[model samples]
Target: MELTYLRTFREVAKWGSFTKAAETLGYAQSSITTQIQKLEEAYGAVLLERYGRKMVLTMAGEALLQYANYICRLHDESKEVVAKQSKGTLSIGTIETLASFYLPAYLQAYRKAYPDVNVAIQPGNEPFIIDAVKEGALDIGIILDPPFSDPELDCSILREEPLVIIVSPDHPLAGQGEIGVEDLENESLILTEDGCTYRAMLLKVLKSNQVTFKLSYEFGSLEAIKQCVTYGLGIALLPRIAVTEEVMAGKLAAIPFIHPECKFYTQLICAKKKWKSKAYVGFLELLSGGAREGDSDAGSELSK
Candidate 1:
C-alpha cells in the first residue's frame, strides 16, 4: 500500500468529509477519492461508506485508522530524531489562556537552558490545539484541561486552577465572599463555547441543580469574555488565571464557588507511544521538577 494513500485516508477519516480532507491536504477532491479507492482496492475491503454528503468509516476503515495514526507517528518520530541530531526544532502548541498567563516564564526559562534548540510556539483555542497535537501537526501541547479519554495520548497534570465567578463590584452577589450555585438564580451569565471542558462542567452543574439563569452571551475568545465582564455585561464563570489581573485591578470581583469550587487540572499532553528524545525529556523534567506521577514524570528520570 502506498503511504500517500494511507495519508489521504487518514485525513479523510479525520475530517469526515472528502472536500474538507482535500482542502486540508491541498489536493483535489477527485484525487482524494482516487486515493481512497486505491487504498480500498489494495486492502480488498470497503473502508468508507457515504451517507448523504458525509462519509462514515467502515469497520475496516476504523481499523486502518489506528494503523495509519501509528505509521504517521512513526514517520514523524523518525524525522524528529534525525532533526534532533542536526539542530531540529520543537513545535509546541498551547491554548490562549496558558499562552497569556503561564507559558511566558516557563518558555523564558526553557530558552535560557537550551538556547541552541529551535522552538516554535503555536497558540490557539483548546480544541484546535488538542486536535493539532493528535494529528501530529504539533509535538506536544499544554491545555487548560484534558479530553475525556484517549488511549493513544499521555496526559500529565501540570497544575490545578480554580474556577471563579466574576461580577461587577456592585452586583448583588459580588460582596457575598463565596456564593453557591443556588445564589446564581436569575443572574445574567456569560460563558465560553460548548466544547470548552470547563464550560461543559459548569453547564452540567447548572443542569443538575435545575437552576436557570439568563445566558447573556457565549464567546469563543477568552479576551472577549474578559472584556465583556469588565464592562459589567454579565457575571462570568472563568478560570482563576484568566481573570487574575482584572480582579486584582478592581475591574472585576472573583468569588469562589461555595458548593463546589469549579476546578480543573491543566495538563501537558503528548502522544503515548512516540519515542522520547533528550529534548522532550528535558522539557518534561523542567515542568515536573523530576517526579513521575501516575505514569507521567513531574520531573524526569523515568524510563520509557
Candidate 2:
C-alpha cells in the first residue's frame, strides 16, 4: 500500500531484473529483493518470478504495475501543477550522441527562456535514459530510437537525424558517391559502444544485406571514434551533424547510405500523463517551434 513499495515494484517490473533496478535506483541488490518481498507480503500475493536469467511479473505483479503507473503519474502530475518558477529543477537524460551533436542549441534556448530555472542532464544510453524517465529521475530524455507506443512515455519527433558513413578522405570508401549497404562488407568498422541505438541500427541493416558486420574498435566516446576515423583508422556510420565539421575540413568524408533503412531519428521523450510545468512546457514549445533540427544534413535521405 505504501507509495515507496509501489514505486520500487514498478522499477523492478519495468526492468525485469532486480539487479538492474537496484543499480538504477541507487539501492543495494538485497534492498531491491527485500522491497519486492515486502510488497508481495503487503499484497498477499506473488509479484514476480524468475524466468531463466531474467525475472518476470506474475499476474499479481502485472495487476500491481498498472495501478503503480497510474498512481505515480497522478503523483507527479499533482507536484508539477503546483510547481512555480521559483521551485524545482528540470532534470534531463540523454544519449551522448545527441548530447554532443544536437542538444546544445535547445539547451541554450531553454536557458534563455527560463532564466530563473535550473536544468540538469545525465548522459546515458537509450535504455538508461528511458528507465530514468520512467522512474521519475528525469523530466525529459532526448534519444535516437525509432518511435513506438508506450503507456508510460510520450515521444515528440524533433528531427530526422540522418546518418552518414564517415572515413578519412583518402580511405577507399571516401567520395564513392553514395555507397550501397553491400559496400560495407569486409570493411573495418569503428563504432560507438555495443549498446548504442545507432550502432544497433547500422548492424541490423548490414546483417539484412548479408554484409559481414565486424567491429574494428569500439569507443565509449563519439569524439574518440571521430578522431580515429579522421586518421583513417576505420569507417563509421554516424549522425551527419557529428561529423560535419570534420567532413567540411576535408579531414573526413560523409558518404551517404543508399539503403532506405539506414536512417535514424531524434525524439523528445517524457513521462506520459504527467503535468508539464511552465519551464517544461516552454522547453517543449521551443522544440515544437523547430529549433531541435538546426543541423542541416550534409547528405542523406530523411523523410518525416
Candidate 3:
C-alpha cells in the first residue's frame, strides 16, 4: 500500500534478488523480503518465484511491473511539478560514437542555458538505449542507426551520418578514393562490439559479399579500435565523424565506404507519453537546430 513498498518491489524485480535489491535501496534483506510479502498479500497473488539461481517474476508480477513503471514515473513528475523546480536532472542514453563525437557541443549549450540542471549521460548500445528510453529510465536517446520506427516512441531523423573505412596513413588502402566490399577480401578488421549498429551493418555487407576476412580484434571502446587501426593492426569501418580529427591531422586516413546498405542516420528518440520538463524541451531545441537567446554561439556550432 505504501509507495516505498512499490519502489522496493520494482527494485527486487529489476535485480531478481532480495539481497541485491536491499543493497541497491539501502535496506536490510529482511526488509526487502517483508515488502515483497506485503505486496503479494495486498494483490492476493504470488509475484515472484525462484528459477534456478535467479528469481523470476510470476505472471502476476509481470503485470504489476508494467503499471509500477508508470506509477513511479508519475510520482517523480508530480514532485517536479509541486516544487516548481527550474533546474532538474536530465538523463540521456546514447551510443559511444555520438556521445563522444556528436553530442558535446549540444550538451555544452544545454549546460549554458540551464546552469543548475544536472545532466547524466549514459553510454550504451543501440538496443539498450532504445529500451531504456521506453522504460522511462532515460529522458532521451540519441543513436546512429539505419532507419528505425517504433510505435511507442517519437523518433526524429536528425541527419545522415556517413560510414567510412579507416586506416593508418601508411596502410595500403589509405590513398584510395573510395572502397567497396570486395576491397576487404582477405583483410583484417578491427571492429566495435557485437551490438553496435554500424558494426552489424558492416558485418552484413561483408557476409553478403562473401568476402573472406579475419576478425583481428573486437572492442567496446571506439578509441581502442581507432588506435588499433592507427598502429596498422587492421582496417576498421566507423562513422566518419568519429575519425575526423585524426584524419584531418594526417594521423589516419578515411576512405569513403560506399554501399547502398551502409546508409545510417543520427536519430533522437523519446517515449511518446512522457511529460517534457523545461530542461528537456530546451535540450530538444538545441538538437533540432535552435538555441536559447544569448546562446547563439552554441546554436551556430550545432547547426554546422
Model 1: per-residue lDDT, tens digit, 129-224? 778888888888888763335777888887776778888877777888787888888888899877677778777788899999889999978888
Candidate 1 residue runs with Cα over 4 Å from true position: 1-86, 146-149, 259-261, 290-304
lDDT score at residue 209, model 3, on the 0-100 scale: 88
**Candidate with maximal TM-score:** 3
Q: Mind giving the per-residue lDDT tens digits that candidate 3 earns over 77-187?
A: 988764544576899999989888778878777777778888999999999999999999999999888888999999988777888999999988988999999999999
Give candidates' CA RMSD values in order: 19.8, 20.2, 17.9
| Clash-forming residue pairs, model 3 | none
Cα TM-score of candidate 2: 0.67
Ranking 2 against 3 by TM-score, winner: 3
Model 3: residues with Cα > 4 Å off, grouped in runs:
1-85, 290-304
Cα lDDT over the full model 1: 0.79
The regions of model 2 sitting more than 4 angstroms off are 1-87, 291-304
Candidate 2 lDDT, 1-304, residue by residue in tens: 6787788888888898999999989999999899889988988999999999898998988888898999999988877656645346888888887787666766776676677678887999999989899888888888887764468998877777777889888888886888788899899999898778878888888877788856889998888999998877889888887887887888889988766766567888899867787778887777766633354531111221
Clashing pairs in 2: none
TM-score between candidate 1 and the true structure: 0.63
TM-score of each: 0.63, 0.67, 0.69
